[model samples]
Target chain A: MSGTFNDVIQIIYLAAASCFILGLHLMNNPATARRGNQVSIAGMIAAILATGAIVIHDGLITTTGWIVLLAGIGVGSGLGLYTARTVKMTAMPQLVSVFNAVGGGAAALVGIRDYSTLGSHVAAATSVTTLLDVIIGSVTFSGSVIAAGKLQGIITTAPVTFPGARIVNMLLAAVTLGFGGYMIASPSLAALGVVIAAALVFGVSMVMPIGGADMPVVISLLNAFTGTAVAMAGFVIHNTGLIIAGALVGASGGILTKLMADAMNRSIGNIMIGGFGSGDTAAAIAGPAGAGVQSIAADDAAIQLAYAAKVIIVPGYGLAAAQAQHEVAALADLLEARGVDVSYAIHPVAGRMPGHMNVLLAEANVPYPLLKEMDEVNPEFARTDVALVIGANDVTNPAARRPGTAISGMPILDVDQAKSIIVIKRSMGHGYAGIDNELYANPKTSMFFADAKKGLAELTASVKTLVG
Target chain B: MTLLTDFIIFVLSLWVGFEVISKVPATLHTPLMSAANSIHGIVLAGAILIAASANSLIGYILAFLAAAFAAMNVVGGYVVTGRMLKMFKRRTVPASAQAPAVNAGQNGGKSA
Candidate 1:
């Protein structure tokens, strides 16, 4: 413990921590994000080396223990790599949810291990801490898995509302809290088992009521839960690093969840209990009012866009599904060539996740300068000549800002203020939020019923023909 | 036996690391990296628990080092992620825009 080697380890740990900070800083943009990852990895290497040194210095772990630890690390790293490589872009959200669950599960396991080690000799305070960690961590893990399943489409994305759904959830939560109390008082294996089961049920009930449209907010909220659980586990284990990291995640996730909820003009409580935006209910409510939408062809839409002096493009999940980013970029190029100023308007909650639109557009090699956030582009929409909506619906819906709608008071892209509107969609189906887009029925709007990619291709072809 | 296993584990870990590194898209690199920083918390927790239980000087030193390093990772990782996201907010083209030119070349014609 007093050797020169320990000094080296300490220095390495410091270096690693610095690298992590630097890596995270670089991660905010596409250009340096990869470099940030690399830097952070370098820091991780240093930390691992330091850990190994410290473990060796302690001389507590046997040879068998070391072997098992190494093997576990190897297997875990391999699985992480395999999943990262093979998962598709569409599945990224689910994968993230699962990863968050894993973190929570690991913390819970640590608490369990600590409890078993202490057994009947454990102090009352330690017992309570362990009980809390187990309860929170188990709930986070199970709930996160369910959320992942929903996002991955392995389970239904709609609210699985049944008779007495809210009542059942409330009862389950009450039971879970009771089990936690029992565990704290007795600290028996049976009590722990009951607590775990109750926690699992609570997680499911918490997430099952949420609909797909509110997934972004749901995911963020669940992430916050996972972080808090991890932090509680850290407190039980007396680990400062875990506590700090968990607190950071918990705080950030909580803020993001609130922001997403605000974007939909809903409260987090309503999202959880009311289950307001489920697909069927939302469609039934929002669809009837906007039944007067008019449709048009791709050629006519192309002509409208071509002659416009300025155009704003709004993208959504449909654009992602069709993989139409590149084609949209091509159409934008054509418009710009004709002396039409083209800009992309991005909503914060535009796609499945935050910054989703930026990722899709970046893949198409769209210039970063042309992509404008909601705040930056909303004001410009009033002066715009045209707003070409590509597979976007809810974000541009006037109902978000208009009264008497579910999404009332939520800010939108202001695309309705444009002199003309061309909406490209596959059908009159509502968006994930289950809301009808009033932009479709506007007098200035012309609906083009086609896949975003196909429509953009046709538009590009028509523009070429017209110019030639 | 432990040494042999450790060597094997180290090699396997490196292989997995390479795979993850290669697989992450340019766009996701930031958020994924930031998320990965959470691993530091686990290490720090382990170190601290060991130290607290054992109450040894060596354990305390090791725990402190672990905690400090992990904290650094969290702060630094977020800073980088924030900067990268801000790049998307820029009114100028990202330096990464060179990808389009390469694709245009491959298609044998400049678009627009």
Candidate 2:
């Protein structure tokens, strides 16, 4: 009867796993995405309950253990709900990083506790997996924390470097490996401590030199690390569910990281090496000192927008920073009423995080069909009467097509091809690529210096009076 | 208990993951990350196992923390992703707001 009971529990786990697979499949379409989340939540609930049954059946948990587990669940649930509900769309990337950190930290602790309990009696296979779990998990934990800090503006977004930074990283790696090797050979608790410590420190150093601009890729990379660590923890405990889920996340995160890097026209290998965007240093080198830029008033810009046959709005990080998604959507709605065609042109790396702009725009109830990707919208720019570039700089730069520039070979929106161009920005500032936007100086382009939110509102007001 | 079985399962899951996830549109990347983050919260099972069997004070403490972290990851990731998706399904701005930017009523129900 007991054997049958265990088999039944395993079958439940299999069912939960299937839910996960189906849930992910449903997330491919916008119309079905919400239901996909619901299905995934149901699977999670089932997984949690099934795991609880297994633990209870083992009869290993003492009264104190039960109390601790209940308290943990309560506190964790409370914290999770609070943050998920309270966090703004702007801080979504940092929140994701924080989740990644905790996931990684928890996986490492599981491996550590398991290793300490087994000591010399642990099998060679388990030992190897456990050690790897601890290393990757610990690294992911610290690295994710730093990444979150950068996104939250708690830490400087500039690439923090020092003399012999590469050498220091190498030395840390060697020491971590050496300690890991010692633990494998002897199975002592002290060696394990050293391994964990070295790995944690290495994590911080690795992410510190990666500038804020490169954080989206870094977050994705750390996400993959967290998944691999979880898989390692699964191996230690001999749990197939954990292994499958972890492997899935690891593989998906890896692919997303590569795709993001390709979108930026940079290699994953180069990004991992760090020191790409050094913040102000790169900005100073390509500063906009002598560019011939023409500034247009809100009403003047409104004249161009109100009468345009077709307007393509290109939104970037500045738009997100000013929380102008709703404003832009409102403007588009206003224009559409006048029979002027409007659609958003989204560059792959436009926002700080992957799909950052889409999430923000979605919040404003922008129609799903109106948000167009780079390739789909590039050809439409030439036919557009007015290309309204809002707070987007680098991705619109013509410099990307030329060799020897900071953003050489990067894909850009064809805003310059439009018959007339209107740019809304705060001032003549460089974008994250730390370079000037060549499109800003084009004869066809006129700059309107203002915050994205204010600029959109003003233009909306102006169009109302002028067009009516 | 051959390690090879787990290895094969791991390798196969990776392929399945790549195939399934690559089809997700760019619009859902945030939700995709959140969903994937919750899936890896399966590590909570390992934490529960260790906690149930832990005999020492330190072991119990470590396991408790691990369980807490994993639980947060699972719960927070799902809730946040759901909330974001709910916004995606919200009705596009009401067609009645034909005036200029003065109509804040449509967005009044939502918080900043």
Query: Candidate 1's residue-wise lDDT over A1-468, tens digit each?
Result: 567976776567557645654554444444555566677666766665566666777777654444445444444455555565565555556766766676666556556656655655666766776776677777877888888888877888788778898888888878877876776666677777777788888888888877877777877777666666666665665543344445545654565576667777778888887456554222423221345777777677777888889899988777876888889988887898789999998876766655556766765657766878677789998899889888777778888766787667887889999998888876777776565677888888888877788888998998888764
Worst 10 residues of 1 chain A by lDDT: A280-289
lDDT of 2 by residue, B5-80 (tens): 8889889988888877887778778889889998888888877888888777897788788888888899899889
The residue ranges of model 1 lying beyond 4 angstroms of the native Cα positions read: A1-22, A26-32, A279-292, A337-339, A432-436, B1-112
Q: Interface RMSD computed for candidate 1 is what?
A: 13.1
Instruction: Give the DockQ-based CAPRI class for model 2.
Output: acceptable
Interface RMSD for all numbered candidates? 13.1, 5.6
Residues B50-109 of candidate 1 have per-residue lDDT tens digits of 433444343333334333433333333334334334434232345634432222112211
Each model's TM-score for chain A is: 0.90, 0.96
Pick the DockQ winner.
Answer: 2
Q: What is the two-chain DockQ of model 2?
A: 0.36
In candidate 1 the C-alpha lDDT for residue A413 amounts to 83
Predict model 2's lDDT versus the native: 0.84
Please report, as a residue range, the 10-residue window in candidate 2 chain A with the lowest summed lDDT. A280-289
